[model samples]
Target: MQDITFKHTLPVQLRFNDIDALGHVNNSVYFTFYDLGKARYFEEVKRSPINWNDADLVIANVNANFLSPVFMSESIAVQTATLSIGNKSLKVVQRIINTDTKEVKATCETILVGFDVATSSAKEISVEWKEAISFYEGRELCK
Candidate 1:
């Protein structure tokens, strides 16, 4: 895997309950970190208020690979980036890393699709959204 250069990074605080009996952060908790990263990323990129409950996008798929265990004692961060944009969906990649040593603990990629709430169906990626993401990423995205 290539080392990803992330434009956005968010510090993640681990909770005591996040640890399993094995003395490491539970795998499921990482998704929450990624979600925070995604939210922050969008908040910054969109440059406007986002009502998550009324957001027009929905996560279609998520995949992650755990490289190592995360200990509660370590300071951690989640890095996020927009990989590409398609007709109705876009790809986001993220990684959880040890902030002190820069070791990546896990990597994840997700596909988010534009959704119509009232119609209850998929929708085309909005032009406004594409421009916002592309401007923030500093590059033209795939169609």
Candidate 2:
């Protein structure tokens, strides 16, 4: 994981509701941090506003590993990067980290497919999207 470089990071705001009875952040809340990172990454890379009503991509799957517990006293951030792009889908990876300590609290990988809401079907990844991501990452991606 240390070899992978992330170009985007979004600070996560902790809310009282995010905590559980165990006195730590609830596991489910990490997804929201990843969502924030994803949204910001797309907004920067695509250089276009994302319309959720007609989102360009839809999450097909998400896998996360909780490395450590997050307490309310710690400041956190989510780092994101595009892992790979396929013909009709892409993989994104994110890490939730303690900002001050630089300790990763959780890591996640999400698979997303280009989607068409009108038809409720998958679509091929656009050349523009691939280009944008590649340009942002400063490397060639997608086979």
lDDT tens readout by residue for model 2, 26-77: 9998888888899999999988778789887999999999999999999999
Task: Assess each prediction's global lDDT (C-alpha) against the native.
Answer: 0.91, 0.92
Off by over 4 Å in 1: 1-3
TM-score for model 1?
0.96
Summarize candidate 1's per-residue lDDT along 1-143 as a digit string, tens digits.
46556889999998999999999999999999999999999999998768877788899999999999999899999999988999999999999989999998999999999998889799988988899999998989866
Residue 8 lDDT, candidate 2, scale 0-100: 92
- C-alpha root-mean-square deviation, each candidate: 1.1, 1.1
lDDT of 1 at 19: 98
